[model samples]
Target: TEADPLADAVAAAVAEANEPQPSAPTGPPLPGGEKDAFRVAVGQCWNVGSLSTDALGTTVVVAVAMQETGVPDGGSIRMLSFSGGSEAAALQAFEAARRAIIRCGARGFPLPVEKFSQWRDIEMTFNPEGMQFR
Candidate 1:
């Protein structure tokens, strides 16, 4: 039997429609800023200097939740995931990130309110090897 191009096209269209669509940004995103600056700001607010060299290679993903008024939930910093290094290292990294949140203060996270919507539920991956935002 010959191929049915119409059937193929219909199937493709249906498949595309069924595919999960990316969610729209909850709020406007902030204009591009230096990620390094953001990292430095957080680093300054917390102390993670005691971790051993091995732990320094770990990366932890931290999620911060914000409220409607642009205020972050006081205890919303959560360890979503991690990569590289041992479990202990990952735990240390997670704690460090949390401490940064606590110490930095949600309202002073170095992000403008203009970007609050986008970051209301943002996850930040912190790599300890170089303190870079991945």
Candidate 2:
């Protein structure tokens, strides 16, 4: 048994080398949340808004829009509008805008209409005509 100490060492090394490395965490889960690509797009859009604000506000806007409109462009427009409205009016406007955007061709996913109720948050009604929401 003592005839091959070097062989045992080599076997151990091979075993260690063959073991899989731990994968990097892919960040938090995102089933009912915004996708990563969409988040980056939203960040780029927010930077263009010239507003000094926090991520939470931006995140809320993006999430509500995505949940309501599905189209990236439409969601951004709605959020921008909702941001400036009074709280109560904004919520009402958000619901109205969501219905409008859906009617205008924004599609929902993962839950469909019956399952996912339209968002009625005050921060969801940014609709300026002639501006691009595509």
- lDDT values, one for every candidate: 0.71, 0.39
lDDT of 2 at 3: 64
Candidate 2 C-alpha lDDT tens digits along 54-75: 3113222322434444442454
- Please provide, for model 1 over 13-52, each residue's C-alpha lDDT reduced to its tens digit, 9 standing for 90 to 100: 9999988654546455565564456657776665657776
For lDDT, the strongest prediction is 1
Off by over 4 Å in 2: 1-81, 106-125, 129-134
Report the CA-based lDDT of candidate 2 relative to the real structure. Answer: 0.39
Cα error, candidate 1, residue 5 (Å): 39
RMSD of each: 7.3, 13.8
Q: Give the residue spans of candidate 1 off by over 4 A.
A: 1-23, 34-37, 68-71, 132-134
lDDT of 1 at 66: 64
